[model samples]
Target: MANVQVGNGVHRKHAKNQRSPEESVTEHESTSMGSDYELNGSTNTEVQTDKYGFIGGAQQTPGEIDDVPPDVLRQREVKWLEMLNSWDKWMAKKHKKVKLRCQKGIPPSLRGRAWLYLSGGKVKKEQNQGKFQELDNQPGDPKWLEVIEKDLHRQFPFHEMFVARGGHGQQDLFRVLKAYTLHRPEEGYCQAQAPIAAVLLMHMPAEDAFWGLVQICEKYLPGYYSAGLEAIQLDGEILFALLKRVSPMAHRHLKKYKIDPILYMTEWFMCAFSRTLPWASVLRVWDMFFCEGVKIIFRVGLVLLKCMLGSPEKLKACQGLYETMEHLRSVEPRYMQEAFLVQEVIDLPLSERDIEKEHLSQLRRWKEARGELHCKSPPRMHGAKAIMAAEPPSRQDLQQNPTIIVEASQGHDSNIENGKRAKKSKTEKNKDPNSSGLLNPYPLATDQSQGLLKEGTLQGSNQSLSSAEHDTYL
Candidate 1:
């Protein structure tokens, strides 16, 4: 076998004898998984799959088992159905309830639909009808199309959907990624986007998955997949700054070892932890991420650091950068359990304002260290809630007027405008329901509003590492 270098230092081995691309890909898939599998079990199946369609075998250690009873799931499904039916009402007037439901976890049956709603992908699809099909039909840039082809089978090989080399899963994955490159030709394609699109395809059809990918690349995370990857690099600095407050010990250990945040966090943040976390935990995090925004991602990273490197004993084994990097790559199962990680994320005292504050600090630092940053785009609206609240102008509006001006009300602060804080006038402080463009969904609980925003305080009465067991990653 001959090894061929792929992106991100990953290598794929080819047979000694030359073969066509399709032949090599088919050979690769067949040899990699021993045999092909399908979504529904076949008579000749070699392994049993779990509820989520991942192949289960003696080699794979079970991470977290879903303990929620069926009846409970059914009841939650009913509630979710109600919320979905009245999604606008829930988002408008009962946002707290929506947030609470999302934190609890969206029912598995409704996860795909709820994600479409929460990501604002459904709205984007409705607004731009038949756009994905148009892009899919067009011949994409040959450069990106080839790259996307090579990466198709690399995503979720263990899952039945992507096990076959030229299966529907791989086909849909190619379409979504190729369409994205066509949609945003300037950005082209990035390897990290393959897993994200693959995960979306697992839940929804190709068209919906494409829109979800669009929402993620354009709205939830801007400039993340662009040339030079300047946005993700900037966010890496922001994550390091946040670690100073979230877990000082972990932050200091990394500083002492001179481990750059980008070294370990690139996969974690860019793929939204789809590659790093357990399958169940990945879905749970995405549920919150689509609802909230990048804050869920930041919180997850902080939680992992706090669990793995917060203590001296845990840091002792990680004496050097290689050990630390290995430890991060192979996360301990206990730390990534779905229920535990979700709760830690909910309790963590990290907020959007904290991220914004650190973002500004990091930008200044970057400018001082390395002159002007090219391809640095302005930050987009944070999450689904913020996106819906802002009600961004339609594509038609943008097409008609290339530059849309936003008029700031007198004496009112516009954080999105200049990233500077301003004092509100007396009348502005009176809390008018309609003043801020966002309707006041519910009366803010004094403590709930201000509690998690406090520095150096992890709320919810549950400490990050409550158990005494010290488990190390293999």
Candidate 2:
């Protein structure tokens, strides 16, 4: 009877401790280390401990970022440089072939940097950024910047207006030229830069183009637009003289008609013939120009006149003698470049020698033509009694290296123009001459010139490319 009573008490205790199966499962999920559940009634992916230490519904990602090696990146760069250099050799060889046909060479896509490097300019852009940060450290930057800033739009107003209107190449040219003028003040401002600047900006970034302009001015086309404008005038006279030699009849016709090639061609030499050709052909000429020098310009100009004027039949039908020039100007795009490239006419290697000789003769002629004026290191002039007498400066007098001054009171004291050229008409010659502004033969603008002259504070072509390309062969 005692044993039965104890067993009944134990059975009652076990029943009290037991839970329903669903409640047991819920409690185990909510509290157990190996499982999870939501007490707040929101569904979510649960975190739980497992043999792996921690597990979640989220998937694991593969591998660390350090797995790739850096040597591979360096190797790829070296390979690319090799390929570019090999192609460079290919271009050089084709350009150098003596009897090679003149064809429209493809404009280098690397034109902007090429222009700079070829011209002897540095183009590392990071250099510009660091240079900018060090601007305060550079003492003369302010004045140079001011001078360049003033000419920015003045040098390129048409471009400025074009860019503001969202035309493609114009803006790039403006920025590059402007930045470069800012970068190098020794070449502060000059004519003939506009079109070349435009061309460079078309192919490369503006800053790179800026350095290119520098290279051309500094290295390639030396003394072209320096203070005296002597280089441009000298080249022009040389071309004119060469034209007369090449085609006497045409030169006579031009002379008889009082046709000034200088008027039409000034635009050409000033910008290195860039204005006359499609951008690519001009660049091809530039490629040769880089390899050669000023002589290429003369050679090219000689050949151009030979083609345009070689035949009386071709030239005689024009209404005026000047009409031939107009025709050359108006030649269809296809024929113009081909006319320039033809080998039978241009004969590059043979012509290159002649051009060099011609260049020497031209220099001698200039020395004879202008006497002491062609000398780059001009003798100093002091306004002494001899200078006041208005006698030509003696070479011996200059050898002593005395500082020289001509009568600044007379505006043409530089002798670039004779005092006679500056001599006012009889009525005004004796009157106050100093009052007259110094006569600049090539004043920056003219009435016939575009009348826009605003101060500058700021700162190329393309497609229609293929038709322009094939035209060089004709």
Q: Which 10 successive residues of model 1 have the least lDDT summed?
A: 465-474
Candidate 1: deviation at residue 315, Å?
1.5
Q: Global CA lDDT of candidate 1, please?
A: 0.72
Best-matching candidate per TM-score: 1
Estimate the Cα RMSD of every predicted model relative to the unseen true structure.
Answer: 18.4, 35.2
Q: Considering summed lDDT, which 10 consecutive residues are worst modelled in model 2?
A: 456-465
Q: What TM-score goes with each of the models? A: 0.74, 0.49
The number of clashing residue pairs in each candidate reads 0, 15
Give candidate 2 regions above 4 Å deviation: 1-117, 122-162, 165-175, 182-186, 258-260, 318-334, 338-353, 374-474
| lDDT (C-alpha) at residue 417 in model 2 | 62
Q: What lDDT tens digits, residue by residue, belong to model 1 across residues 9-104?
A: 212232221122244344444322223343222335355555565654222335345457867764676577566555676787988888888888
For residues 1-474, what per-residue lDDT tens digits would candidate 2 score against the true structure?
011110101011112112211132343332221122232232443333221111221111112212214344323323322322332332335434311211223233233333443343332332344442232223333444344334434332222112222122333433454445455556555646766676565444445456566656655565675677776666676677677778776576667767666655666667877656543356566655544455556666666666666568756755475686687566445434533453433464434445446657877887786775542632211111112122332223221110112233453446546566545443464563433333322222242122211111100000011111111110
Per-residue lDDT, model 2, residue 439, is 31
lDDT of 2 at 90: 27
